[model samples]
Structure formats: C-alpha cells, structure tokens
Target chain A: MIVSQKPIEIVNILTHSNRIKTFYLKLKDRIRVAPGQFMMVWIPDAEEIPISISYFNGSTMGLTIAAVGETTRQIHKLKIHDSLYVRGPYGNGFKIPRGINKIWIIGGGYGIAPLLLLAKKASSMNVKVISFLGARNKDELLFYDQFKLLGEVFASTDDGSEGFHGDVTTLVEKYLSVSKTDLMYACGPEDMIVKLIKLACNHNLNLQASLERLIKCGIGLCGSCCLDPLGLRVCRDGPVFPLKILVKLNELGCYYRSPSGVKVKLSD
Target chain B: MSINVSLGALSLRNPTILASGILGTTASSLIRVYKSGAGAVVSKSISINPNEGYKTPVLIDLGYGYINSMGLPNPGLDEMIVEFKVVKSKKVKLFGSIFASDIDEFKYLASKLTDYVDALELNLSCPTKMGVGLEIGKIPWMVEETTREVYKKSKVPVIVKLPPLVTLIDELTLAAEDGGASAVTLTNTAKAMKIDVFSKKPILQGVYGGLSGKALKPLSLACVFKAYEVLSIPIIGCGGIYSWEDAVEYILAGAKAIQIGSAIVSEGLGIFKKICIGIKKYLEENNIDKINDLVGLAHRR
Candidate 1:
C-alpha cells in the first residue's frame, strides 16, 4: 500500500504572533483539500494531533498553529527541514453558499485558522465578506493583514489594541442591529460557537459552524469524540455542521470528554 | 435448524462473528458477546506486552458510525490467555486476534494461543501502527512469510485479517492461502485522519487512525465479493456490518461469515441477535434451506 501518510518537510515557518506560528508544509504530492478540512500530523513518538488548514494553494499548505498543548509545544520546537508526518485533509468541510453575495464570519482565538481559508474561498467567489476577529490582546490577533486582502474586518482585542474595544460578540450585536446577511459562519471556543449558534438560530439565518471534540481514531470507530445525548461523532459527521443539526445537540458547549474518557465540564 | 457455516477449517454455529477490537480484551466481555448470540468472538488484537494506548479521544461516535485511534490497547497475550483459560468458559467458540511486529513474534503468539481458542486471526491490518500492523500486511511477501511462520507452528485454524489499503486485496488473500492460512478476514479499517478546527489541532492524540462503521460497508463488501471470485478458501467479511441487511449483503456478495466491530458500540450488544433474527427471517421468506446457500448468490447472474 502506497499509504495515505508521508513525511512532509517543513519548507517555511512564519510567526503570525508571539504565541501562534504558521508552518508551510509540502508532501510528495499536492494534497487537494477544501477550506474547512484538516490534517492529522504525527511527530513520531511524541504524539499526533489534528491541524486545520490555514492556506492551501495547490503546491503547499499553511497551518496557523498555536503552541497551546504539549504536542503543539513540541511542534513549535521544529526548524526548517524538520520532517512532520501527515495524513488526510479528513472530515467534512464547509459548504459554500450558493448565489449569496454577502456573508458574515465570526471567530475566536486560534479558531480563525480554518475561517481564514473560508474567507478567502468566499471572497474569491464574489461574496462580500465581513469578518469579526477576536483575541485576548493586540499581540494575540492573527491573520488580520491576510484577511484584509480578502474582505472587510471588524477586530476585537480585550485590551482595545485594535478595532473594537470589547468582546467580539458585542461587535456582532452592533452589526446585526443595522443589517442582515445571507449566511453566518463561525469557528471558535465552545462558548463562542454556542453563542453564534443561538444568534444564527434566532435570526433564521443559515449557519455552518465547526466543532472540536476528543477523538481517538479520527475515523468513526472509537466513541471518544461522540457528543452526549445527540451522539454525533465529530470526526466524520462533522468538523462542520449546519445550524439546524447543531441546534438540536444538547451537549453543544455544556460538556466534553477528557483524553481518557472522563466527563468534564465545558463551561469555558 | 442448523445455522452452522464452514469458515475454512472452522465451522461457526452462525455467520455472526464478533469483529476484533471491540470489548474482547477481557474474558467476561468475550463471554458476554457469545451469550448475546455472536457465533464467535474475536479478541482485541494482543501483543506480547500490554499497551496503554493513546490518551483520551480513543473513540468518537459519528451519527452513523464511530472513529477510534485506540492504538490497539490490550493486555498482553500471555495474560489474556491465562484469564480466558481460567475464567471464560471453553464452550463458546473464540478467535484470538494477535498483533506482533515480525514473523517470529507472530509464530510464537500463534503457538501459545492455539489450544486456548478455536481459531487465530493474525491482525495484519491495524491502520494506526508504524512498523507493524498495516505496515507489515501491506507487503505481499511479509503476508506470506508471517502466515507461513505462524501456520507452521499453529495447531488451530489460522486466519489473516488482511488490510484493505493493499493494492490488490486478492493478492494478500492468495498469498496467505499459499502460506497455509485457513481463511482471510477480507478487510480491516481504512487509514483516516481528522482535525479540530476549533482548537486548530488534530482530534486524535495519535493523529492518524482507522475508519470503520456504516461508511466502510461498500468497500468491505467489494473486497469479499472480489476475494470470493478468486479464492477457494472461505471469506470472513468485516467492516461496517451494522444491520442484518448489511450482513446478508455480505453473504450475497460471498462472505461465509461477517464480523461486526463498531456496530457493537453504536447499535448495542443486542445487535448480534437482531442481525441473526433478521437473517433468519430472510432465509424463511426466501425458502432457503441453509444459510450457506445465501453466500455468493450474487455471482449467479
């Protein structure tokens, strides 16, 4: 089997901010992928984790990763020429809205990685995209310049270092007061996505939001990433789901399982 | 009303085989599966040593199926065999699925497990590992060598759980048969991966893992259908046999028996009888005398 996995060379690395870095990766061949799709990266014996695509322009892909956990901490230690094993741009991706010329995008923290690509895809399709970007501080804000190239941006940093002086949700509340859009797409913290889902549901607007969960086999076999009560396995049925399906989930930010199968509170 | 069907050298009371990598790691779990109506239960793929496996997120419940990167977590074969011999009743037909890195390890495990279980399923198809599992099963020569070494030493029926990622599924089956394998578990999980866009991180700690569930049905059914066309030996159809119709589809496509893996978790333990009853109902409606007659019926056209 000329398997799905291969050792990819780190061709380039760009520091997006102090905490977040983007790696330019190239495998043996072009890994065709959709904007919201993701890759499973392996660092040999250390640990493997999934990373969403920030940019894929045929030849190479960019992963805007933050040094958040132990695996990502190790990932940040790599230099140019270091090899990283990768398989897939797996899981379902976002569905581009048809005939809609206007879209509103919302994201929090590192969740902006996948939305960056989606913004590019949407804008390139002649859609008027207005992105709402949020982070803890000015230094924490990511892809502001890259996003500026595609569409309009309303940014928020907690310290008021950028566009809006407060929370991203407040920015959305202000925007929704005056105008409405064809679709609202979001990716971010559970609380943020949960809030976005409620916002989208109340407006009766079409929404596609990505969700994250603990997953064992990235494929649909292990039950670790299953959402409670609704029982939706995040790996296959989604990394992305429509508002109608997502709104039905009872566990949408209320709880999640830990790495070893403990039910932990997801209030954060 | 005998539902027995010959799976190469072994004949199961019915065609419902509990696919490996479920709850078969423990003796009680194996007994539970048997009691629930599985014709046979395959153990979790055991190595010579215990594996802690990957951290949390070993399994995810997909609306239709599930994803797992469990890393073959199991107690060592020696320990598992001891528990089976001590606690598990010997009356239930048990198949041991063993994972080893090389030919010698495969041979040794097969030899040790021979008298304890009725059959040995060489787990050559686990998708998550590196040097072994699917890596070993991918090479036709390794498939032959491992099967030959284990077959020479094994007293019971030796079946190879072939990886679906292989270039030619039939080649692996033919090679195993050439190496004296009694049968081939037509396929195992597909190599797949996923990431959490929310965290901008991967879902599984191991990154890459296997894909099973309702999605795998067509691929596995095709494998059994193709293998049946080329082989004299019996085919054990696995991968996504969730319902009775799925099992019967495998039967019509040419599987002597079918193995259920993810469905055990998604549908529940009672799924075994559900499938059996559904199959029985089909047999009655069609006026089929033996369940074996349903096997490979699709080839008649």
Candidate 2:
C-alpha cells in the first residue's frame, strides 16, 4: 500500500535547550513505531526532514528537533495546535535481543532524543539501563533528568560543566574498562559513533547505532541517503544498523552526500 | 519464453529497466539495482554544474502516486564521470541521463558520458522551473536540435525522454526521430502539485513538481500508443509501471521496453525481478514465444 503524509496538529510543545525543542503531535490513526524509526516532518512549503520518533504512546508521538537548517528553523516556529504534515515511522529501528539483562545507551547532543524512548522501553522490560549523554555544555545536555528516572545516567560536556569532563565516548570507554554490558545502543555525531564502534569492538559488545544522512525521500526510492560500497539505502535498509553491518560501511563517519550528491567529508 | 528485447544497439536480458532518478545517483546504487535483476539502469539526471536542488518537502506520497520537485540535484558532470567509471567496470547496461537547457550543454554532457555508458538518455522532461526540464522538452525544435547535437557528438545510442501532457505526441516523437534519436522514452512525470489545506500552502517547496505512480500509468500508456503510430524509433515506456500486467500493457501499447520508477518506493529493488517474472508468466500463458512479438499488439485490431 502507498504511504502518504497525514497532517497532524501539535498538541504540546516543550523547549529542551536553546537549539532544541520537542513537538508532540497527535496522529489520527494509530502507528506502530520503534525507538529509532523516524517520521518525515513537513512544514508545508518550507521543507520536509526526517526526525526520529522520540516519544510514542498509542496515537501521540513526539519529534525532538534541533534548529540546524532552514527547514528545521521553520519547524521551531510552530506553536501548539499548528499542523505539520508527516509520513512514515520509516526505516528500521533499534532491536533489543532476548535474555539481555543490561544495555548501555550512548547519545550526544540532540541525538539523545531517540535514546530516551529506548531507555524508557528497556527500563519497562526490566533491563538495567545506563545512559551516557553529552553535549557542548551543561545547558545542551538533553533529557538528563528523564534518563535519571529510568536508571543510571552519565552526563558529559565538552566544557566540563556537566557530570563528566570529556566526550561521551571517553566516558563510555572508562565505564567499559570497569564494568560489563550486554549491548550498546548509540545515536550521536559520526565522530562519537565511530569512537563508540571502536570501544564496542574492544569490549566485545554488540553496537546498534541510528545514523543520519541527507535524506530527501523518507522512502527508499531516493538515493540521497545511500551508504557507499554496500549501496544500502539509509532510508530503507536502516536508520538503525547492527555492529556487523556498520563495520562494513566505509562511508560511515567518513563522508555524507550533500543535497547535490557531492561527497562532503565529515568534519573532525 | 525469451524476454530479451533490443532497443537499437542496446540489448537487454529483460525489458524491465530501472527508471532514472530512482536510486540512480551513486555507483553503488546502480550496481545494486543491476544485481537485483533490472535489464539495465539509468543514472539520475546529471548536469554540467552541481545543483543543491530545492529544500524538502521536495517529495510527497499522494497515496496513488508521488509529487516531487527535487529540482535536478546532481554532483555535476565531473563527479558523475567518476561514479560512471566504477559502474563501467561492473559491466552492467548503464544509461547516462543528462539534462541541460541548451544544445551546447547537452552536447558537452553527452560527450563526457558516452564512453562510460551503454547509451545516453537526454532528460528533456523533468518537471521543474529550472528552464531545462519541461521548458526545453515542450519546444519541438529545441528537442530536435538538442537530440541532433548530442547524437552527433556521442558514439553510443541517444534516447530522448519526453515530457508528459504535451499537446502533440506525434510532433515530439517525430522531432526526436528527425534529430537522429535511437529511441524515445515516452513520457516523464506529469507536472502536478498538492496543497496543505490547513497551512493554505502548496506541499512542495518548489510549489510545483512531477507526478509518478499508479495514477500516471494510463496517461503514459496513451502517450506510448500515440507515439507508436507515427515514430520509427523504439519507444521506451516510462511512468507508473508497478506490476507485470502494467509492463505487458505498455509492451502491447507499442513500448519496446518499460521503465520502473515510483513503484520502487513500495516494491524496492525486487520490483525489477518481480515484474520480469510476471511478464514471463504472462507471455508463456498467452503462447507468445518472445516479448518483442507482443509490442504494439493492442493496435493490431
């Protein structure tokens, strides 16, 4: 069946930080969405962008967005009761294997949005939840209090104003040395995720990461979000991928295609 | 049943071609589609210079189809050539689709891509306000001139993809034939738009875009059927082909081959193989020995 965008009104709005805000929308129909699967949020006539589902009940879903581009800036202007056209709950989401007692959730900047939902779900399943969240400063750390309520929460900031004085990956590395976890779930900047991949490898932990790309069509038809070598459509094959597949993607953390299909190198 | 069909100098194992602009930007994507059982694959429309394209809401699923105004985004000829080199090494039937506003630009793009591709498809019909797509395609003389110039400069076969909803299918087809086009792709996406009633604004960032999917099938088939009556060049039917029956209908309507586009959104790469299987089953059931024998069958009566 063909999937079309449904215009949903923003029921509530929450300001998370200076750059980030969460828009809670009520869907007309119930949608079964996983933690990392995203929605193509359209701010009519402005642009459409993929925002991961940060919160979902039966008919209500929340999209936590950072005002980084022009379209996102438009989304930030939206108030409660405003309509945003949305399609999907697209792409694959994070999968928690059975019999796993504990898992580490690593997130950085606004990436913590999707991981918060994961923490909530995992906590409900009686799985021990340890979250490591980082941002540029204490003010930027996302969902710290929410994560604390679920289980253990480690907050990091680049300027040393938060719980840990370094990057979240460094904090993860320090923790991995002292303790053990069944799996590691991450959603963050490419550099942070790449570092986490290495740590996961050394610690022999399976890692599942929600990656980002320049997505035009949330459906698989557009090659805008395709990864190199494997030619996997990031929109279809994954926004969330396992450690086994992530290790083979040469483009991961190296470069991402621009809107014009140019390979722009990821900034170090 | 022998499903192989030949379009001038280009031969396909089957008539199911991966339509341009659907996962055709990267070399890896082309290879992936090729391996998924498409007879050939067309690259996304490339241009002389890099284009950032329009901002999103560039595309929307209309339930029956999609309306998109991607604005011909590409990494310029230089980067595409690098991508083509990798695809060439894999030995897949590759068609380089290029779009330009003028004859000189078309000639330049065709010359640059001819070496790496099996054929060059002139994208004269993308529905954008960029003064290139339907703007150039609508003018019959411009179509003739661009096709003639590119065909002259290029060593491989040249295919002209025409815009849909034009006044005269015969004029466009004859113009391409007179300009030495080896084949013609009968119809690109129809110019269309959608609006958000709540916002009181057009859904696409570009205000207008091209429509593709199940809704476009009959329109495209009509174009192919009309073009078949007047043109000598092979007709490559494109627009809204989703299933095997759709492929058969296009073939009977006089299309030597068919292109699969928007359906890939729902069917994935496997659509190629699925449609091919369906066509073969159709031919076998109908007692047709070859797929070529079915072309223009609808006009036989």
Candidate 3:
C-alpha cells in the first residue's frame, strides 16, 4: 500500500538490442521479489513506467526495458550512477509448481526478459528448463546466451535466421508433437500468449503467463489497467495470470484501453 | 439492521459510497466496486476530451493519508458513455462526475450523462493547476451558477462536491442548495504539498495535490457540521473515512451518506460491507429502526 518512490542508483547498464537495455540498480533495502513481479520505475523529468524484475540477486535488481515509449526512451539515455526512483516489486509473481521436474519456458521478443528470471529460479529448484525464444530475427533474440546457461535453448526467428524457421508457437507445436512437457511458462505479445493458451489447452498442459497493460498508479486505486467483465486490476490482481484466468479475459488480444481510458481496438 | 437511506429521488441500499477518482475509470471497475458492497459509486471526474493528466509521481503515501494530483485524466465523454452503458445495464447506482472550465461545457456534460447515471456529481474541487477545480469552486457565485445551470438540464438529481475551505463551507453549501442542488458532497481533498529533500522538488508532478486520508477526517467533518446548520440539502461526507467509527462521526455531524476514498487503498473494498455492519449494529443497539433516523440526530442535543 506504500505509494512513495525511493531513489535507487543505477549500478550498471547492459545493451541487449537496439531497442532493449538491461539496467541494474543498487538497492538500499532488501526487496523480496518473485520472478514475474514488476516495479514502477520513474526517470527524473520523464514519466514512470512499470517494468518486470528481470534479475534480482537480493542486493542489486535488474530491469530489462524496451525503448518503445517516451519514458523508456528517456531511461535509455541514462548512464551508470544516475538515480531512478522505484516503488514495489508489486503484483503476484509466478509461482513454481511443487514436485515438477521439467518445464517449458516460452518467450517472445523483449518478453524474454522475465522468462530468464523464471528460468533461473526453476534451475535453482532442481527443475529442468527447456526454453523456446523468439524474435523478428536473431538480432532481436534477447538473452539467448543467458537462457542457454540455464538449460536447453530453442531459438526461433521470423526470418529463419535461427533454430526454427517460423514463429515460436510453430516451433512449440513441432516440439509438442514428439515430446511431452509437464508445464509451460510464457511472457510475450498478447496474441502470442493467446495462441499459447490454445496450445496449452489442446495439449492438456498447464501454463502461467505474465501480461502487459496500460498501467497508471500501479496500484489498485486507479482502474486504468482493470480487465473488463472480471474487473480484475492488472496492477494488483495480477500482471501474471494463469491459463484459467487468462481465458476469461474477453479483452485479451482484441482491445486495450488508451492512457486516457479509452477502449481502442487492438491492431492486427 | 435496515440501513437504506434516501437522498431525494435516489435511494441507496446503504449509505457507504465510493468517492470520485478512486477506482471509477472503467465499467468493470465501477461494477467491481458495486459488487464489493458499495451503496453507490462516483466516477473519476471526466472532461469533454481526453486528459493525460500529470506525469509520474502523481500520488504518494504520506503514511497518515495520501496526497495526489491526477489532473483529472479521463478518456472523454464518448468513451465514458460506453463504460456507463455497461454499468447502467447492471443496475449499479452510478454518479457521473464531470469537470469543466465553463457553464456551456458543464451543461453539455450533464445532458450526455443524465441518461446513463443515477445522478450527476459536479466536480468543482479537484486541486490542480487546471483552471476548472478550486479556481471556480472558491467563488460562491460560480458554485451557485454552475449548480443551477447543470440542475436545469439534468433529469437525475445533482450533487455538488465542494472543497473543504474552512471559512467558505457555509457559503458554498448554501450556494449549492440555493442553486437547486438536491445534495452536496461535504468536501473534496484539501490542497497540500510535499517535497523530496535530496531531489529538492515536489513529490507530485503537479506541485500541489489534494490530500485525503485519516488526516482529512476532522477538517471534512467540520465542513459537514457547518453546512448542515445552513442548508436543507442532504450532505454526503467524503475524505479520510477508513472505518465505521469515522462513518458514524460523519452521520453525527449531519452527513446523510459517506464516501470512502483513501481508505479503499489501505483497507481494500471490504471496508464497505464492514462499515455497513458496524452502522447496522450501532443503530440496533441505539434502538433505531432505520438509518435515516440518525441523520442530523446530534443537532437535537
């Protein structure tokens, strides 16, 4: 329920792609963050935006951001030692299922950031991780080598410049035909996640995914990120949801609210 | 155990209301609040066009309460109507709050929302640099004129939400009543500010924001008490109401209904049901049959 932002100094910055950079901040206090939880990051003189906790070693936290919007673009210009204000490792993060030995990790584009953290956590729990990473091309594939260090890595590029020749879902389908996985985890574009949900449902496999929305106030007070029909606030109720809840969200991949709370049709 | 109260033509199953701008942006949110047991809900103040509002740090938790300057961001009228249609279909008691810089815009907003909402709440007390909120509300003549103009066009009851200006509470309440308002929401947030010492800048993007929480209860209670002595219209007390004790105090001070805002942040949506249970028990213990019997009862002694 705390709304005040505490200043955290950026200790290091790593460029992952032309549009993505991973910034590590030194924490003044210990923040217990699960793999899928996010933080509201504020850049001085710019806007505050929600970013997933891509890496956390108890003392230093990493936020892998895509320079897609004004706030993130401003965040990209900052160097090491510049301070950024942050509040929360908020929302319910991904929960590792008990007694599971093997799991499939699927990520698309910049969505690969959070999955890497989940993979790391799973690896530590003695679970086998099989990751499927996808992007427009090999150049956009985020954390390929990092994800590889955890377990088996399957890469996909839309241009056929990587392991698979088509979208990540097509690669997942091909793998699913010959192999059986106990569970699946994902964080990516809504359309890709929607496709994964269908795949999981058809295969009778359980899937957990981290979602994205136009968030304001990053707390439940403002209803900017509330999902329709269910009235679940993406900020508090979840940024990560399971297949059961994901299927009920009628607005998924079809529409999204603009910053002003206007419901606009999602472009195909 | 009966807690139903009537505010003119409008009847609430209970007296607990969701104050404007807390969680009122979308239809799902309004319906969610209704499902959470709120007697009624007021929307975040909307304008004719989209407002992006202030940037990051628009709100902060001061431990005692909250200070926020959201700058009245909304998706404008047409988009809000789409959300209102869903809320109306579910039969939720919705009060559409609108803010404008002038009479013509207020009239237009009222006409558009009258069909969708149970009532219209004129938001004249949002603390911001925007010329619409306190700038117009601090003027007694403007309050009267704005209320009168909107009331004329509104088919549903009109509730004017005023600021908690200590010396002006009496005049503002009287102006609202004089201008044909069916009810007056005792107060909006008090204007306040906070600064970050290291950064040497205001915490909120808007230099000044409205303060709401436990800290505001006394000021708002005083405003309600003062207004009740002068105006015949029902007073809906808002600000810093977190518990049933706070709700009872407002009733004693002559508020017909109470709006819960900052408390929802700390206590969650369950506060509505909890408050009602407390009030029902208090009434039963006091040998009262209906909550309406407690309205302005403190003034008797």
Native contacts conserved, per model: 0.10, 0.84, 0.63
Give per-residue CA lDDT, model 3, range A104-221, as digits (tens): 9999988988888899999999999999999988877888988889999999998888888889988899999899888899999888999999999899999998888877777778
The number of the candidate with the highest DockQ is 2
CAPRI class of candidate 2: medium
What is the C-alpha local distance difference test score of each model?
0.79, 0.88, 0.88
Model 1 chain B: which ten-residue window has the lowest total lDDT? B56-65
- The segments of candidate 2 whose C-alpha lies over 4 angstroms from its true place after superposition are A1-6
What local lDDT does model 3 show for residue B136?
A: 77
lDDT of 1 by residue, B144-226 (tens): 98898999998999999987753488887888889889989978988877665434566666777788888777888888888
Query: TM-scores for all candidates?
Result: 0.60, 0.96, 0.95
* Local lDDT at B273 for model 3: 100
- Scoring each candidate complex against the real one, what DockQ results? 0.06, 0.79, 0.62
Cα DockQ of the candidate 3 complex: 0.62
**Candidate with better DockQ, 1 vs 2:** 2
